[model samples]
Target chain A: MTQYTAVHGEKVSLLRVLGPGHVWALGVGIVLVGEYMGWNFAVGKGGALAALIACWAAGMLYTCVAMIDSEVTSTVAAAGGQYAQAKHIVGPLMAFNVGLFLVFAYTMLEAANAITLGYLVQTVGGMAGFADTHDKPFIVLTIMFLAFLNYRGVYATLTFNLVITAIAFVAILILFAAVSPWTDNVLKPHELLNGLPYGWLGVLAAMHFGMWYYLGIEGTTQAAEEVRSPARALPLGTMTGIITLLIAATMTWYICSGLMPWEYLGQAVTPLFDAARLTGSTPLMVLLFVGTIFSTLASANGCINDASRAWFSMGRDRYLPQVFGAVHPKYRTPFRSIVFLVPVALVFAYFAPLDQVITFSILSGLLEYTFMAFNVLMFRKMWPLGTIKRGYVHPFHPLPAFVLLALCATTYFAVFLGYGTQLVAMMVFYIIASVWFAGHRYKFVKRGAQFTMPWPRPVGH
Target chain B: MENLNNFQLLEYAAWGISALLGLWMLTDMIRTNRAHSEETLLSSKEGEIEDSLVIDPPHQGGHL
Candidate 1:
């Protein structure tokens, strides 16, 4: 049996595993892709401000879920993430389903990021030649690069994320400064009121796009086990990163709007680049293009690194194939999971359109978040106040938990109602998972496989 | 519309109430630890600590 050591022979403290700047970078990386790619399609200039508010609200809700999860798992910080946490709170049958969706969420997100990276490479001036005949090849190269970095382990991945995020930030600041002259153009009173006719329902519907910008707030929680001091670092990193992303996203939206007309932005394929052109500086445009490329790559890398861990954890628990669970002895990482994920991402990147992939990715992620939010509520009821140790708690108790549960479920159902194709696809995927889990259960029972229940028995006999 | 805004305000007030509830939960966790330690002392005196710590019945495998 291989023994797992907490420190892994390193004298690093939890704070040492991450600094505030690193946390900010991770948070910014999470939001930038959505802002750059999905924001226009999700919401227009009038709806952007509302979307920002929605993102903050969603961030708070996700933060609450993470708090409950950290306390429940004894702060073990496993890669299995919510799948591992769900298995402990709910039963394996439910967790198996959650695990399947979790894998789908991360893999789909990887595909989305890779496809976006390909487009960015093609559109950016210097790299246009690379784009002409080599779209799929570019995606494949990106997948390979991300997979290798992730396979190296968490420290290298976070360091790379920090550097990429810093570059992206500086690029955004330059773009903002260049566009500052057009600040008046960006803050149109009419644009802010454009969606007013739709009333609250329209605003809420438009929030679907806003929520996309906030999608990855829960990502760092998945890597809680890899962080040095999960108990303290997890909450601090998560909250700070979320706040930073929220501010950056809001500012980016404002800057872009200020630099161009709402009509142009609404139709823009690459709005930020267009905003850069307003500055009339070739050097700055080049920097922005490079930043966009780095942003997509960093986001893809983070998704793959976190997703592989979740898959490996499921495999270790026998919910997935045994091969996925095998850690590379030398690398101390899940080499197989990383290997499997990259190809799947590349296939989707090559075959699917960017918009379709984004929709599917967001839909799958929404389902997983709904399940997780529900699990938090369930854990609160089952474990109650006294069962756990001192860990961060959500500001509002059952109320915030209850409100998030309601809003998340409502949004999920609303999306299902609107997007019939995605609903059908999600149903088919769940049905397949159900059949696989049933088959696995039969085989295990026949072979007398040992079962480990999620919860520990009451303290004293 | 104004009434609805008031309702939103009320909802915010409710959130404030819940924040207090969260603080109460932290206090409860502290109280539970003290009680657990006392229980452990009594159980140890009665030679029940080891028995309680051990997993009963050989572990069995199946969907958990």
Candidate 2:
């Protein structure tokens, strides 16, 4: 028995309609086409062999993050995802930080998708003479269009996710067919061994691009509150999504890299398109183009859905304004937060460079990963064993979390050293969040808000 | 500094916007606190749950 009291006194709560399939769609939709565009940039950083090595490392990292996150979701099962878990496992202030980081990460990723989709449309359609600046009109329209669909309701949003994710899968299979004939001719055995053009350091530098392969798959947790049966569905959906992504990532790497020179693909704005073109098939390029469109649209749409839920959860907890926490009376969706996110995404799409936007998005996600891993350990320490029944538990408690923490720190350090400016920009964003958290603390104390950690105490302790 | 390009300029603008957002949140917090009084703020237990919904130990996996 649960209810919501919006600031305006409107009755609001999220409807539980999503099942395992929709959960899987939400998880995979946000990251289906990583091998399409931004991932090619990794080849530029680390060459073909080094990039593949980086990809394998990132895949393992995502597996750990996903398993640990599945366990956390089983406990909290709240819409705020990591933010909600952090509040229960850690405290309110850390939850606030996680909330803001989640919002920034998802919104930036959405904007990047819109920007790249615009570029793809221009390239695929062969539009001429509009290169004076990035296509602001196209990007803005895409954001508004996705936000509009989101505003309609969650059912429409998830339905769109399911459809497009299927299309993306089919598109990849066709793409494999397009590249298969040429793979034997163009792929060199020597490139496989001697292709570490930038050496070991390049692997570190290329990690962000490697992360593109499975960056947002853990967004499955964000859907915990909306799923029909969180206990059973969350673990199954998320684990299935991870395995699917790993297969897609491996296949995308092999076929795309083998079909064309890794150096050339590295520089390509649209890697799949370049791979299709290499086969010299007009129909194949068009097929891959459709897949690219589906992939970008699904990514942008799912980001809005996930980010708005995070914002809504924070507002419900009084971290943000109560207005942000409000769900639409008729649709039962977080319309205000979803609407607010549209313009912010459009602003980024218009002003920020695409590569910088991608880096910042991944960086913010890594920060959230570090916090989530820490929260896992905190939960174990506080709850101990046999105290609570969990549906899915990762083996060797704390080991996976520890490994994830080390990987996150190393990746952040690499990004700071390689891309200093974006790192600084994110730090400034964190500073602002900290300042707001301080003010929030002042308000909490002034208003005498009750604080409680929702963990059970052992009798002796 | 002399060779600052459009992208650099954009980054500065983004930083400025972030700073402004911080100030706005702080001020909004103060204003909300002033408007509602401690009594009204404490009356709502919107997100708090009655019992601890801690994670249950797995039936299969060994206890931590």
Candidate 3:
């Protein structure tokens, strides 16, 4: 007979699963690429002061949502993540919607990253004489590479990320220091605020752009269960990750604005790479290229892994399909979900342009964030914990949560209104998810099946 | 330098720190993983429970 521990076994410790360093690396990896791509544009349009404030606001808002997730859910495994959490709190249908949105958004992100990676390779390949290749072949190769690495499992993926993140971090610092002499000439107040559409509406629109940099704050929570001491580590690790990224992003923005002319910076195709070139170091340019490529790959890998886990969790719960729930018996990874995600990403990659893919991804993410913020408030009210844990809490409580919800909702509508095609796409996504849920429910009823949370049973009962 | 401004200094510092921190994080990952095997072995013997059970059953309308 096979031996099994009681369901209510000992709880895992954080130190064992995710060391402080790995957690930090994971946080840095998520923010670096997005900021590298868009920070200059955001700061130049909003002004340093405005950008800084927005970064803080958005970061804190994201952090609150993550903490609520950690507190409300018992375990922080990568597989179930937000979809599972939402399912537990609300009903299956809402949970299914969250899963659907997340899968769609993340798949779009994979496509975007692949395209961007192609562009990056083309840019750098110019130096190495490979010549520029367009979308299809590059996208296919990139997807295959990421899939292979992810399939190798989390350790390999994370290890690769750590190395790449380190190199990129060094390149960024060197570029910043080398260009330090040009700061005064580049830092113009009007440059910061110019090129913006106009007024408060423009600023609000700009905030939507800023939200891109803060995209993965809640992602760390998805890995909660994978980390050892989830109850303690999930909250602390996530908050620590967020705060660190906020500071890093803010500083990077300020430096980029100070070191390069905002007008020129906004128009540049490879802003960070260009910044490195301006530093008068050819080696720095190469470093920047490598760093950027690494950051993009790392971010793509993390997104695919986390997203696949969310889908798998939903699938296990019967909100999706049972196939997603099937863990690789030996690897102990969600192989089926990963398999499902890769082809969907490939299809999107083949058809969608990178910019459109990114915009759609952001729009979907905002809707999820709106629901997440609302979930936080609902969780706080419905399930009050007398003792607040060591993790950071929003100072304003319901107000901050409420404000974030309203802002996220407003941002979603604004984006939807501004982009007609994306709005239509969003509608189609919702409809598809609804139809899927109805079908799932019907099947469940036909089989006389009931849904239940995946939990540890009490020891020896 | 009259040409250089606060914005530039902040940017330099930010990038500088990111590089340093990134490098540190990498080193830490490698170092910790080396030590981790033994620690994991010890902990596995402790027979700790999974975190999933902490949730009040899903029927109670709690996040699992």
lDDT of 1 by residue, A1-461 (tens): 32222222221111114443444455456556665656654345235445445556555555555455445433334556677677666667777777777677777888888877765544442343322233454566677667766664456677888888778767777776665535464345344434433455545565566666567656665665455455576667666766556665666676665555555565577667666776678987788777777778777877887688778767666677655665443234566677777668877888988767776777777777777767867777776666654346665666666766776766665465457687788779888877878776434421223233333453441
lDDT of 2: 0.73
Per-residue lDDT value at A220 in model 2? 85
Model 3 per-residue lDDT tens digits across residues B3-64 = 65543443344445535543543453344334334223112111123533321122111111
- How close to the true structure is residue A77 of candidate 3, measured as C-alpha lDDT? 38
Q: Of the pair 1 and 2, which is ahead by TM-score?
A: 2
Residue A41 Cα positional deviation in candidate 2, in Å, after optimal superposition:
1.3
lDDT of 1 at A142: 70
lDDT of 3 by residue, A98-131 (tens): 7776776677877777788777655544554543
Instruction: Name every residue pair that clashes in candidate 1.
Output: A14-A229, A77-A225, A186-A258, A449-B61, A450-B61, A451-B60, A451-B61, A451-B62
> Residue-wise lDDT of candidate 2 within A103-127, one digit each (tens)?
9889999999989887765553344
TM-score (C-alpha) between model 3 and the true structure: 0.76
Kindly report which residue stretches of model 2 are placed more than 4 angstroms away from their true locations once superposed.
Answer: A1-11, A127-134, A181-193, A440-455, A458-461, B1-64
Which scores better on DockQ, 1 or 3? 3
Candidate 3, residue A126: lDDT? 56
